[model samples]
Target: MTDPVSEFSRPNVAAGPNPFSLSALPDNVAFVALFFQRDHYCTNCRSQVQDLADRIEEFHERDTEVVSIVPESVDHVEEWQSRYDLPYPLLADPDASVGDAYDQPVRFGILGALSDFFGRMPAVVIVDRRGDEPVIAATHRGRSTFDRPDINELIAELDELRSA
Candidate 1:
């Protein structure tokens, strides 16, 4: 049930003096929802991230950690976070290695191949960390740029996990 991406090092946008890494998640963390974004240019993706950002406290109350991964550099993610005022960490996947590992799409069709150079398809991967090793609990792969998980549904799922 282990996904090696959990062992990868990524730059945390909010990491301070004591830098953070995926492997360094808090012990109390019940699970981690990894939101894979195409890039800062996708408004739908931004909105999705914003929705999660707005409900960060609820996530904390449920002992779940949410993170974002973008197929761009740390600097780009930093700028995007500042623009949206996101409180959670945005992990940089400059080469899309993590995205590739999770099978996050690079494009849809021939014309979409253009995205291969600049973007990643939107996706949501929930990894339950309560077990000895992180396990994939659920996942949603966007069919289009605008596709994303429903906020309410995501919350409900997290709540269900909390009560389990």
Candidate 2:
């Protein structure tokens, strides 16, 4: 079976990198990909991002940057950041291509039959910088989820992926 992470590199990733028209991203950077949905994980993830924000020093020490990517507008980003107290950059990718690039979805099966579904980016990722292919530092989902994961454990896992 093909690995799920490898699935991201496939050619079918369409429709994202929203607010910014620029294609591609910096190669030498570590970023936690915070994908959003209209609700669900998007809203919940704000809390996670805020928690991460509260400990900005730790994230900087680990050399990881928290970037929240969403199809929402700048207004949405502003509202969420202020409401949730998130301290990181809330980037808009209205096209949602960045979410497609990450390839990990929250519910994981809502991509089909769009008429009947509302979906979310149910996971978070710490992607490695400077790699020919970005390495996934840590992903959160399935059982011991984000709000519940050991913060220290998450920090440790992220710490281990330090980019040179």
Residue-pair clashes, model 2: 9
lDDT for 47 in candidate 2 is 61
State the lDDT of candidate 2 residue by residue for 8-48, as single tens digits: 21121122232322124443345444433333234455566
Candidates in order have lDDT scores of: 0.76, 0.49
Question: Which stretches of model 1 miss by more than 4 angstroms?
Answer: 1-6, 15-20, 109-114, 117-119
* TM-score of each model, paired residue for residue: 0.86, 0.61
User: Per-residue lDDT for 100-132 in model 1, tens only?
Assistant: 888887664675556643445789988888777
TM-score result, candidate 2 = 0.61
Clashes of 1: 0
User: What is the lDDT for 81 in model 2?
Assistant: 54
> Local error of candidate 1 at 163, Å?
3.2
